[model samples]
Target: MNRSPRFRTSRTLACAAALLCGAQGLSAQSTAPAAPTAGGDAPATAVLPPVQVRGHYDNDIGTSDAASEGAVTQRLIQNRPALRPGEILEFVPGMIVTQHSGNGKANQYFLRGFNLDHGTDFATFVDGMPVNMVTHAHGQGYTDLGFLIPELVRRIDYRKGPYFAREGDFASAGSARLALLDTLPRPLAEITLGQRDYRRGLFAGSTQLGESGVSLLGAVEAQTHNGPWKVPEDQRKFNGWLRATQRDGNSDRALTFMAYDARWTSTDQIPAALVENGTLDRFGSLDPSDGGRSRRISLSGSTRTTLNDGAWQASAYAVSSKLNLFSNFTYFLDDPVNGDQFEQAERRRMFGGELSRVWDVTLGGREHAFTLGLQARHDRLDPVGLYRNRARDRLATTVEAEVKQTQAGVYGEWNARWTPWLRSIAGLRADAARFDVDSSVAGNSGKASDEQLSPKLGLVFGPWQQTEFFVNAGRGFHSNDARGTTARFSPDGTESLDPVPGLAASRGTELGLRTVIVPGLQSSFAVWRLDLDSELVYIGDAGTTEPSGASRRSGVEWNNHWVLDDVGLPGWLLDLDLAASRARFRDAPSGSDRVPGSVDRVASFGIGYAPEGGRWFGHFQVRHFGPRDLVEDGSEQSSATTLAYLRGGWRPTASLTLAIDVFNLFDREASDIDYFYDSRPIQGGPAAEDRHFHPVEPRTLRVTASYRF
Candidate 1:
């Protein structure tokens, strides 16, 4: 949609003004500190402890006017076993993470019935810094979480749907915010060894910097692996992190720096014909030279302070990254001599910031809350290109271009308690973006801009028996690749093409309930629907855009968490989650309702036994991914797959621990991902349409030893 520059500027300024005014008003009403208690006025300069929230839920369900929002604490992260760091996202309930290429590449994400192809519609953030890349060389929203150091993550806050005003682009399906710990409880050193030549080492620790109440923490990790592929993945990675934090009674501030680098050879997906004919194994590859290399460095800071009856928070970050990838999807289809191999490369720098204020006020004996937030981001990518290559040597260039993108957004929300049992939340958000591209092809260089305004509403009723009912509706959007909005010709400049819109809109509605009536059990159920204005997708492989018809999706999700201690089964926990959905092209012709690559069902179950101060702990978990349509006409489909994991640990002393993990516990033979497409084999024959797949890793065992000083 088109928006006037004057209107966009005014709205942003107005939101900023509101936030400042709220902060000022709260500060003016601050009360004097009370006299210190006990011995000698408690050392006049002592720092106050940070505020803490307790329990399995962050919000007081049935009382707070929120739905589908929850937090996963460090306790859960430490007790679970994940084959890859990206699997940590599985804690988001109903969301699934899988891989189609190699360990160093971004994980394929599926949620809310949408394939989400590498984070297209689901937003992700770490410590207030955006993780999704716009107009990327590989994909529009390519997000790689392999750099994350799981041990340093303090909590993960997640919300599904588009009901929160504070969230912007790429959040139509959902969003996740991860926060890291500013300090470690003690110095730690760990070593891990496993089958398949797997090895890893990690070191992390924190200590006081001086007498200024400031603490410093640092971490370093190095790992190598030759996965289950017959060609050997040969993956190597390195990561480092450092942070300094200061805290004083309900207030905290921190500065953090992170660096990561990785390189690996990928096996890619193998053709069904070859596997069935015994020409190649499931874990074999057509081109062993296919692989990728990537690196990222970032610095960020955040602070929060109390203001009378309210609080204010602010954060800023800067990042630089680079990627180079090689692949041969269609072995000999297009170029029989060169074998259709190509390379995608890009170098980028990004900066962003966010500010927000929250306060509570009483009106007519009823309490109300207000929140205002503002965000801004910019990206510069130079010489992003697509090139034809043979064994990593470039033969020809299809497209070479530079892109500069910027976005600004503002939002405000209000929560009111109409009565003891009724509450409502209303909000509005506005966002604007500008895209500029400079291409080697003369006529393809251009500039474009777009903006949007969205409104949100939610109503809640309940607490009669510790159950809450909610109804929510909102408008959300995801931005298109900047290159797509300005391109006038194909990558080779041989044919003319229409420029796609800069932003696509989506609308969603949800009806849900959350309950805690069973003492130690917490459960939630939600039925939701979403409609997209358009499905214009960026073809990363072709360096162009493809227009698809609009689509609609509806789904149901049920999640449960139970602590068995209250039920006479002490030191036990059980968790179960399930999701089912239907997705189709809106108003499509007969026999064309299916939305390709959309999954129809997903489920997960876990059981764990760990007692407080216990010497031994164990956990068992399973994940199931159901069938999916591979094409719009439903001419092809994929089979279901299930995998289990087991973990057992022993704490020999307060400062030492040992653990063992078994992945793919049952040694199941299944595909991690599957696609139906046309591709020629290395033997050089006519193009054949068949299923391509990457098989899941076989059963493997890993052991770890840790010591804390």
Candidate 2:
């Protein structure tokens, strides 16, 4: 069996060439990067293990006996500073998160190229209770996820691609499920104080009562902070959660409850010029006089039933919320006196509920599995309340507006493990949403319903024991329904003119591969391409409308990491994360429709050192935002920027630790939005609107001390 030197050399060269090619392809699609081995010249990264991840860009793999994907845990969800449920998921790549100063906007989520409508296009659920906003004064919903304190979440799973039916309506692109997994070891508590006069306190406790027939876990956290920035001052939020589980036979069912309170003053929208070129030290902030705040609360529960070799699950829950916007508008005002008062006030209220079920089958052999499910959601919204307009010297005038919208649907998914080496999953789901608006505002009230059907498919192949090849493709859909404006009017039958119903019907796809070379190291890469059609867009003068077709966000990323099997540090782990992506939106009807304010390329990467034995560790994260055009023309609107963050933690005892987080380590200035519309020379050339950007939180430090029993 011994080969000649010439034959051995030729074979070795061929294998090397093939691997090089495969890796190149993977790098361009997957965010997976490669790490250098011991004594090698290449770079190395410490990575989170391939447990399973759910987020906006991918679809469901279900929670069954077959296998479970990675879900964001309570500890992880609470690790960062946030006021609402969506903030925990905002940092994910390919997703844009809109956040006001501090953590006040808890019921709203604008993701995956979606405007902040009713929060319906994206699925929302807690434990098993569906969360939706049926009374979308615009597209705002009643899903107040602000209930779960950073400590209450056992784990959160995100399947961001074509959603499933059992999870219910408004889930064209992805579905979100928040659940409690198990009892914690001990009671944990912490207090955090951050830059800009931010302060937060937290408490948590979990225990197993085998003798009492209960597994209980609960947590409470409250945040009250005054922005060091401007306008949006004196903000506060209180979140609490409780979960109790009872085991019966091969099945275990749990009862969970959550509550939240948030209040804050509104922040003004910075004008275009100041946002684009203002120096870091001179940026304008929301005026302190704007007083807009929202109060939200939710009560929910979910149960699970396990069968022989399979499992069946069902959940039901509801939520209610109210928002008060006592703020001024820079535009669209019909009176000069009220405008001179420098502010206007609007109050909104919303309520909603959800129900769903899921089934699992494992008879197709020990290695194969299948899943089925159905779900429904309902919501009610009051965009605005009537107001008697009275100016300092003018007579009283009455005005009123209301926005109502609801969504319901069903879905299913199937996963297969054909061989020890190959696995795949497929899914389909559909939903219907109704939007109605009535008021003296626009005389544009209508009851319009939109239905969506979507599918998902993905496969993973094991080439070797440690390396797996993967590919995924799915259809994504979102329908325009209405906006969540506190004051706006739509005719009862004006449904045909509603742009949101057909605005979100579009599709996207992705492909990737991963490798683990044995024991302590691994790497992967992937390339993605997305094409959008019938994209809903807007022109300031022409109003909001659905463009003919075509918009996109396609790019490649290379991510990699390694955890040495027996590194000297006992519990210590080394890690690195990297990502890069490109996005663009084109108006098929004409270039004029290609409004600016879109980023072209975005990137992020970082490194960390954690000891295996524990005690203390340090980490650094870096992020890059590509250039963007806020004004929507084909011109450059905002320049790209890079940011860095550093973190350090110390564990004094087995159950106690202290940590510090520092952002903008380099002290660089950044903007949340890009720029303002530049119409200074619009008549001379093409019409253009400049973009106004949201200023970023400046360099600041946050410290937290915690104890976990």
TM-score of each: 0.93, 0.75
Candidate 2 lowest-lDDT run of ten: 24-33
In model 1, which runs have C-alpha deviations exceeding 4 angstroms? Answer: 1-66
Query: Using TM-score as the measure, which candidate wins?
Result: 1
Candidate 1 clashing pairs? Answer: 48-249
- Cα RMSD to native, each candidate? 5.5, 13.8
lDDT of 1 by residue, 54-151 (tens): 23334345423345667676677778789999998998888899999989989999999999988989998887778888998888888899889887
Instruction: Compare the candidates by lDDT and give the number of the best one.
Output: 1
For candidate 1, what's the RMSD? 5.5
Model 1 poorest ten-residue lDDT run: 35-44
Score candidate 1 by TM-score against the native.
0.93
